[model samples]
Target: MLDHFENDMVVINDDANSDSVQTDDSSRLTTVENPTLITTTNHQVVKLQLNATSSSHTKCCVCRENLRDHAVKITFQDRDFIFLSRNIWIPEVARCCSGHLINNLLSKEAVDQNKPFSIRYQELSSSDVQLLLRKAQTLIEMARKDLVSMIQEILMMMNVVY
Candidate 1:
């Protein structure tokens, strides 16, 4: 339960939790903060720092053409797939020519042609790390399921199914 105040501050009317909302006049946001949820937010906010130039780029990463308007940021799925499969890490902030990508992922030609700028360290928040791990697990599970289904099909072809 919550009790409202004149200044829009809220008081949690509970015996177990004695939390009070603070009113920020600047942002006009009232929040009941918890120490453990300092880094948590209603929406996903991933903080990443990579030693690569991502802004004010004249040349595209895939082709050596002067970028004017048709530039697109590489999608997360493409980055994760390329990094996991090829061990080449492309920063999330990196952009390339729109022609080189399909649905924000690198085209087949671009995947074969473009390479990483250089080896650099990338920082990710805890939630981002967890998301990456979950993605890897899901990919692995999908591959396992595909293998199992294929094996079952092969066994059926050999009249082994009950």
Candidate 2:
């Protein structure tokens, strides 16, 4: 029999074994293979526990360290030189031991925004300089073609009958 009490524990009366299960506030009972458990509230005190497993170790891509429960979601930018574009990724990362994000990627504007839960940023990588050069070449070629077409259009307009 399961008795729902006003406390944070569930009283179990096993008739088959005739055992008396005594649960205390200090000890917690959890089912195997899952972190989330059934939680109950008593006197406005919510009791909940998350079981940590081997897979629970979340690593930060920048620092390559395991993350803890208290973490912030940070936005990271990746510039691929071959693609001529920038990519943004928002990931939940753990703060470093120095109490700062890895590589100091967090921007000043993000700090001024005062959103402790989330931070946004954009960064220009060194490799993207090559991509910018390529983009500039493409733009120059397009402009040269546009200028030739405009000159041809003006010549034909002047030759037309009034």
Candidate 3:
């Protein structure tokens, strides 16, 4: 998810092992500094550096999955108007495989937060009301036709067998 910070600082936590990068929001300009190496508890810190001028290589920021064909690019905008009027420049790319997982996690989080309940209730209630009305109208029309047929049968019987 995209997060806005004070002083035009925007931090995007893409995946578990991706490092946060700073960028200018408006112009989409990025400055690549030397990769800072740090040791982690579980995995070794392999410093993967990207040259400032390279293009057309796709990789998921979160899972580091190779995105050869389909990818998602997220752009963040600065929230605080005092910092700058432009959006943040951090561009994130995610592969099709891990993108679904990330989206599911986000959806699960929203459901856990009770966000889906309100939306679901509204949609279900409206459809249910419509269905109930249609059923009732159909029943009424059937009843009316049955009564008309009965009356017609009585009239025919009275005129016959004289």
Candidate 4:
């Protein structure tokens, strides 16, 4: 798969171990024109596509899984205490996933003292997800390279021929 952050493509295969090469022009995002689906060895299908701008994807931010019910949409104002002009829309779908985890945190802080149900929910941005995915991809590549180097060194020490 192509590194979402960089133009180079790093292909990981179970049998091959490491197969990475640089390509200038490679499809990154899936659009109507170029809708290509690539399947990895792990049976996970990755579709190179752009995010739907109309509504947020129904996936949990904390755990990249299908969101459960009991989600409520809350508006969060980014400021010390007072209100700010900027408004961030935390959709119901994404809110529910994080609400469960943060509910107790807010309770421990005694948020009720200041305001009722003062659970602050931040807006989930696609860029943040992209950056995380990029970081994961880079780490995987580094690990794969390290593993290959370690194997080669072990074999050399044993006077084994490939």
- List, residue by residue over 23-79, the lDDT tens digit for candidate 3: 564634333332453221221122222111111246443334566555544322111
- Quote the lDDT for 50 in model 4: 24
How much does each candidate deviate from the true structure in C-alpha RMSD?
10.2, 23.1, 27.1, 17.9
Off by over 4 Å in 2: 1-121, 160-162
Give residue 97's lDDT in candidate 4 (0 to 100): 44
lDDT of 3: 0.34
Assess each prediction's global lDDT (C-alpha) against the native: 0.62, 0.38, 0.34, 0.36
lDDT tens digits by residue: candidate 4, 57-141: 5543323346567433322221111111112223333332445336423222222222212234343244544554565576668
Best candidate, lDDT: 1
Worst 10 residues of 3 by lDDT: 114-123
Runs of candidate 3 exceeding 4 Å displacement:
1-124, 160-162
Tell me how many clashing residue pairs each candidate has.
0, 0, 4, 2
Ranking, lDDT, top scorer first: 1, 2, 4, 3
- Give a tens-digit lDDT track for model 1, residues 129-154: 67888988988899999999999999
Whichever of 2 and 4 has more TM-score, that candidate is: 4
Give the range where candidate 2 is weakest over 10 consecutive residues by summed lDDT: 47-56
What's the candidate order when arranged by decreasing TM-score? 1, 4, 2, 3
